[model samples]
Target: MIVSKVSKYNTLNDFLKSKTFMKIALSMTGCKNNRYELDQILRWAIKNKVPVVEESEADFAIINTCTVTSIADRKSRQLVRRTRNNNSGLKTIVFGCAARAQKKVFEEITEVDVLLGSMQEVITYLESNISDMKKCDDASLITSGEAFTRSRALVQIQDGCDNYCSYCIIASARGKSKNRPQKEIINEINKHVANGFNEVVLTGINIGAYGASLTTRPDENKFAELLEAIFEQTGIKKVRAGSLGPEFFNEKWYKVMQNPRFSRHLHLSIQSGSDSVLKRMRRNYTAGQVTDVIKKLRGISPDIAITADIIVGFPGETEAEFKETVQFVKKNRLAKTHIFPYSERQNTLAAKMEQVPVKLRRERVKKLQEVADICRSEFIKSQLGKKAEVLWEHSRLSGRAEGVTENYIRVRVMGARTAGSITSEVLTTENIDTLL
Candidate 1:
């Protein structure tokens, strides 16, 4: 049977084009960009009439991997191993940051059949191997117009990053920055709108560096200009941005915050609040600069939810530096914080510095997480009596519905609400929960 199958097809493409039916399963562990890529692959599979099934029953499995942190890397490897174990005959394909940055790690896995380093490679390989594959309409390599799930759609405006932060491996994994054309982005958003998606999140590896690569019509390529174009050109009701660096905030960005359609939540990628730590992290902005940006954002929208990503235990971080971070979180009254204990990545500058003890790193994470919880509760309490637009995402049988506000606040209401319906509700203690 094996000899017959081999003789029937000259290449993988021939087998794909043959009358044989194939099934595939997808798994991923990463950020929004990874999720977006997986969604694009799913769209392609659907277009080709490929059945998506469970890993145990699949002929092939695509694993979108991540290497942002040591934990993420471990998880990525474990996911691949578990998927391969599910079906011994399954062909496993690995891709994304981890596959590119730590190629040998995946290469050592005997279960992996193909390893793609980048989204372009993934797209090219699929297009070449799959017969009669439809090309994506947009200039970007990924397909568009499909909602990420049933609710909000993610529109990738850019990919990769040049900012080599001392502790980040993503820059190396993703390679140089690449910007999608503004018209392509706008058209993508319009497609999501027509598909019944009211919210579209503008996502990228480093969205702050959106237009750095575009030379022609430089004025139109600026990040703020892209935002303005989306507001004016697309029917998207709510536009949310992904994690942004301190450099993203400027006079132009401040002006765009005035738009009613723009989401009120901002997740700043300010790794540390201590200027010394910031310098060690090779961050361009200072602690004071981040404070100023937060203050200005509040001035523009008092009810805005300002969140941040903070690394707790970078190498050589002293108690004073950690306190500064805690104070900064308190002073700014951040609505939420995505906190991480520093994990040293090989080939990065910070990895060579004086290492913080694993125990200490975990301790710092706990302390800061406590503070973040308090700030989150305070922010939710402060929103009481304020009106908010809630996009219902989940409904229960007992006359209960849960959704997120424009400012990213999670709210639950006592009524039958259809998922995907946007409704205005006055936030009260009963409706808003401070747990998130």
Candidate 2:
């Protein structure tokens, strides 16, 4: 059987087209972009009458991988191997940033039958009989019509990044920044609303950078115009913006956030709290600027959830620099922080600089995490006794349905079914997960 399969499958396109229906498994190891890619692939498979199944019971496994950090790269490789090992005779296809940046690494795995860089490459590979997959490297982004979700719809309005932060590789892997047309974004949202998704999340690599390059008619704020259009055009009950950079904050955008249709929560990519660390990281905003932005947001809505990303120890960061970050977090009372220890990346400026010892980085990470835990508890405590809307997702806990609040807090409400979004009074802070 193995010999027969090998002889018949000289190319992936031929193998795919030969089958009327094949069971395939879809998996991703990274951010919302990967999730978006996976959904697009699933839609394409269904259009071709292919049935997607679990990795343990599949003829093919497609894994969207990440390479943000060394750990992420290692996990991406591990997952590809695991997918192949779990189901013998499984053909694996690896793609996304990890695959694009380190094609040779995936090629060496032997289990990866196809190494693709982008969604456009995956679609082209499936549609054509091209044998050389290497040529598909660095393929441009493709706009997805619909992402497969029943409750909350995530719309990718933009892709790629222009901000080449010192310790990052996404700019190279994903290529230059690009935005989907305003009309296309609106149409996609309408389709999801038609499919019964009440909540919509606008996501991208740098969503806050939307419409910067586009030709505006006259005196048009592109991001604001887009949001206003979504609110006026669709019946989507709740709209959420994805992780926006501190640089994207402006008076026009802030005014849009005041609209009742927009979600009260916002995630800013602060990267680091110390001005020195932020400058070293090539971040555009300082700790003070971030603080002022949050202050303005709070002034708009007192109960708003302002979350941020913070890297604990960058290269050459001193003890004083780390303390500055700690003080900043404590001073601003950030609702929650996505804390991560700085990881070195190859071919990046930070990687060539003086390295901070892993032991020290881990220590600082622990200290900051402890502070973050307190802030999260305080935020959740503040939410208690207030009536906020909860969009129930699934039954993760026993006798309770898990959902996220408008302010991005995950709470499990008793007897709350996973349906449309609803408003509920926060009775007790007990048993509610504090992590946002």
For lDDT, the strongest prediction is 1
User: TM-score of predicted model 2?
Assistant: 0.90
TM-score of 1: 0.89
Error of 2 at 64 (Å): 0.6
| Local error of candidate 1 at residue 184 (angstroms) | 0.6
lDDT of 2 by residue, 1-436 (tens): 0111343347655666555445678898988878878887877765554556778767678889999888999999999888878886777767899998877777677677877788777777655532322221212222223455556877889888777889899887888788889999999889888877889888888887888762111122278879989989888888999898777678887888898878899988898889998889987678898889999999899999988888977999999999999988888888998888999888999999999999999999999989988988888888778877778776654678777788988877667575555656464666466556
**Structural similarity to truth (TM-score) of each candidate:** 0.89, 0.90
Model 2 off-target regions past 4 Å?
1-20, 129-148, 214-221
lDDT of 1 at 29: 97
